[model samples]
Target: MILNARSSYSRLLLMVVLITVIVSGSSRAIVHAAVNVPDNIRVAFFINLGANKYQSLTSVATLQSTDGMNLIWRDPQFSLPAGNVAAGNSVRFAVDGYRALVLETADLNAAIAVLKKIQASSSAAFVTRLTKSGKPVYQVTEGTYSSAAGAKTALTKWTGSGVATGVQTLISARVAGPWAVETGPYSSAYEAEIAADQLGSAGLDSFVALKPREGALEYVLRVGQEQNESTLPALQEAVAAAGGLNVRIPAAGESYALIRHDMTLNGNANKPVDFYAIPAGSGAVLRADPAGAGGINLLERSKRTYRGSMEVSVLNQSLAVVNEVDYEQYLYSVVGTEIGAKWPLEAQKAQAVAARSYALSSGMGYNIAHVVDTTLSQAYFGIASENAMAIEGVNQTAGEVLTSQGKVINAVFSANAGGITADNATEIWEGDDSFLTAGAESPDDGPQKGLLDWYYVALSSGQAGYIRSDLLADSGQKHISGAKYLKATAEGIAVRSKPQVVASVEPIARIGSGTLVVELDKVPENTDYSWIEGPVTPEVLLASINKRAKPQITGPLRTLEVTKTGPSGRATEVKANGVTVDVGVSDNLRGALNGLKSTLFTIEETGRYSILNGQGDQVDSSGQIGSLKIIGGDGTASSVTDPNLYVMDGKGNLRAGTTAPAFNFLGKGYGHGLGMSQWGARGLAEQGYDYQYILKYYYKNVLIEKDA
Candidate 1:
């Protein structure tokens, strides 16, 4: 019977995998006698494509149809149980050469009814069998055809003529005709009748059938005789509206009949088949024309050549094309993009193994595709990105993978870590992965060492802060003075300050522009061991601190201090104003401070204060250095530093002027200091350490083994 698009979809023979394996292992040998790897994985290349809303790949591509569906190499064979084919009017189709567009349902009675309905429209035949789910299903078609294209044309032309509601679209690999629909897999015949009765009461036809599963008989209430889509909806809707009835449409495309082609004395009965349309030499050709200048142009820019079968299907409203490829071959482009193709051989091999492990361990075909061609999973650029070194890496590793506790590991890696790697829970999202722990691998010299000495200043307040030395501005001067500038003393050049420096004034306070006027040679050439920041104004400091910290800092930002640190001397906790914040996990602290480089820093205010008198009304009057009055002469103050000691205002009160100080930060390192540091790896490689050693230094207790 003809069905609408939705009804035809409902009539689809849903093919689901059912695997049962029994494995045995001993010290002498390991046995995998029952293991079954699927011959082909079905990926939804497209779903509901275009304004025309076609469902099958053949429908969209206008490929040829056949008397029987093209069978995969592993399909079980069967024949139509009844109808014209059973009545000797139909010829048995050769499994290899011919195919048919069959409507499949999980119920045997429904299959017979559908066959009768199709026969009423035109002369058609059908067959029946049991699905892996133990449900009786049916397969039926119009006539057997030798070529797929001719069959497709016949199905399309016949369906378009408005004879059937919907054209049969699913190409069956079986050489049978009868189609069936399944209803109930009830525990008892009584339960099956209850379901059948409910459908009968709702003006739907149904019956009870028995099937065997795992050595037990199951009673199923088979529903509907016609495969036409238009008739079932109203019945289903009525049953649903009636309520209290456990009626459900059979799952779409969930059942397939296993058909076998039989040979007769008149030579081989079935024609030879191509199985899954797989070409022998170059693999299955696809829409991507090999004759084109650069093969297929992906996303309109990158042209790529792929070694695998390509299948196109509809997804949502657009087309989804999947490249079905071997797992190892998929790594060629991945390794080349994840790490440069020119990387050291050992490093590339390490990367290849890691990528392979990740791919094998990951569940592919999630979004109807094996893996997206992006870094969201692994960076892939097809054949265009592959190189000799990448191929060598793949070859060397072969089927190798890093496994922990008998399962493949998820080897996650990142770029440079400044110097040290952080714990997995500490650097990435909170998770205690023992494999990812903090360790020091990067050298503290060379260009790597130059990452520390950079510095920044509050452009408005002259408050200075430190960033990575490599990120510093080119050619700028900060004319530092007061306690920051060194002064020659009896003991040597030292930071000039009061005896009780912390208690007396702003710690590390200075005046003028806090620039690094010292010669470049003063800081070692290839070393960037430290960074400094801020004499920042209250407003800017508050904004920056509140942005990164939780519970938003209240009041004016008064102080910022490193309250706690991790093993690498990186700040794990900090205090903004009076609020103590924990930044121990991930890169929370770095993100909090905008771009703090790393969290190893100390806080300092940038201005000095004068000692006040005991009365709290005036500057100190004692005859001491930096006091308001340095000396007394004729009851008057005199000193080299005292400019206006006792200037009387109009009210005869002594007044003096003072300056306010801003805040500053001094720090070290860059990033969260987690995982493998790319720069550190390079340095280690330069120092004769191999990639395996580098990986071991960062990730602990992982065994690199080849998959059997």
Candidate 2:
């Protein structure tokens, strides 16, 4: 995988002497050990090439390391961060290799002719220049592959008329490395880098590298090439006072060596490089100095920086960028992103513990990684999101996690619960831990005090939901002074019985844009906490019901209503066109509803007619309109309703009796009402509740004891 056009990344291959021992083939025990509280973590920031949050697939990634970048070294048993990622200097890693069957020709024209001939058989053929035995030469090659064997196998079926019988397999790479005399094995890459820089200033090919210690990594300064045992004595002797060793670095392979400045050879972008006697890559770690002074940075991603080092490796056709960070340092960013860093310290602490617990139990990204740096798991935005208070919260609650039955709990959370947390996780996970239990909602002071901001509003029929603040305009205190009302800007929207977009729910009333409605009781302008979505035509709603509901709402959608609700008043089951579709959980209902934010809502109809029964009481004729008769002024009776009917409007104009109803999902909250609600937590924290108390409030009867 191409990480960057030019990039350097690797750090913390080991933690302690024991870790080094494990990595260096001493013990295999730790490899299989379960993760409880990991000292270091791997968070994949770039998945494939286009898989990052930024969605960029550029072949180059630049990195700056504070501890100095380390070279990666691995045997069948271990792979770890080795040494020298320096500060200020940018190290680049890029995807720069391909395997191809090559034919060397002394002349460029001959190579081009051969390339053209092969192109007829394979679309990837190319011609480029290389050096052979001190002479410049041109070569024709074809195909892209991460491994040499893959290219070799492809050569067997050659069919080009001009194909060379003496074809050689070549792997392309951009590389620069040199052999050198080594200095002392310092304790840190920072120390080694300073020494290497002094030599580099004096025009030596100097750099820092790492070697495994018992469980830690030690750094060495090396300077280089053109010197064998006889010629290297002078270079070694100068460092002999510092315990220098006479070391000769060998050529680096494309597997671990990348040329920072070399993307093309002899003006050919696809040509393999000639190392020019320099050591290209021997799996030697070259990196930004992270162990020295400054932090590591992802130069292309808005220049977002990080406290920890990075691991850049090949994955499929693109590079994988993984952030290697201390678990606690990781929380400095995660805690702030999950819960507001400016929020109460207690709330942040709760988020820290929960986030930690969730990461441990989530089993995400396989073992190659623990999690992704996105909300698909949890938002991890690097150092920019870090806050002092949030860091303090992380430090104060370090190593703590929520566990039930002696195991970590999957502490799931969301933005808002619409005043009630769903009680369905127990059903999903098949456990009855009290920590996952939730009770009926009491009162959420968050929306009341306006601290938990939202565009709250009520319709003329006394029904309400949160509206997007941007959609509403202030009434200019038109209703009353010192009191503001929001004027609805658009009309004829669907109002559903549930906030979800599920088709199983029958279409309800359509609220017009100019309908009189009350604005928020607290702040006049707010968020998605309450919203109205649509006035869906029956044709549209029917299609959705059939697509989502099992047993598929088989006919035209006549009536859709919530038939059952969980303890939190979240719709769990509904009937579409009067047919029962047993949606067993609130979350499932939410999923079936085109991923609506919540399931707490009410439905109303605009064109619906009501019947005055014998008791003189009005009954809505929504789904049963055709069953009743009406007495006209002339005492003549006719059928109730027709599909092609017109009626006179109040303005003395004629219009269709039914305008094909649509629905508006008017409800509070922005996520699955499960476990803790971010807004609710903020509200409780404002009410002087500590994180522990808040956790118990949302997650019932669960103890907030520290991890055992």
Name the top TM-score candidate.
Answer: 2
Model 1 weakest lDDT span, ten residues long: 81-90
**Model 2: worst 10 consecutive residues (lDDT sum):** 273-282
lDDT of 2 by residue, 1-708 (tens): 655533423223224655767777642111212336878777877655233333324344667655555555552344665434444445555443443545655665556656766767664554544343334455455554444455555554443343664443333221111334666566665676566555544444454554444544466655543213444566665545433433433223412232222123224544343111112223332222366535677875668888766666555555556777888888889887777667777788778877887787776453347887877677888888889988988898777766665567778777777776667643222245567646546234454454333444555554545554545677665433223566767875554443333467653456667655555343322344565454445566666656667667676665566676666676666676667764444455555554566776544333354446779898765656456565699987777554423333345333223323334344567666667777777777777877776766766644444533
lDDT of 1 by residue, 1-708 (tens): 778998666556332111112222212122223222223222223333445533322211211111221211211132121111211111221111223445555444444555556556553243433232323334444543434555566567544554334434233332322122455467665676566655555544345543333444455544543323455666566655643245566553322221222111123323211111111111212222122222222322233555444443234423345556567767887787776655677777767767776666555534555455555456777777889998998887777766666666667665455456655554345577676657664652334342333222222222222222332233443333211221111221112121111344443334232333221112222223344444456677667667656678895554566776666666667776558854446357766665566655566543222354446554422223243343365676644352212233445333222234355556555445555554565567667766667667766677666545
Highest lDDT: which candidate?
Answer: 2
Go through the candidates in order and give each one's C-alpha lDDT.
Answer: 0.45, 0.55
Candidate 2 to truth, TM: 0.54
Candidate 2 wrong stretches, greater than 4 Å: 1-36, 47-68, 78-289, 299-303, 314-319, 363-365, 425-433, 440-528, 536-561, 574-588, 603-658, 705-708
Clashes of each: 73, 82
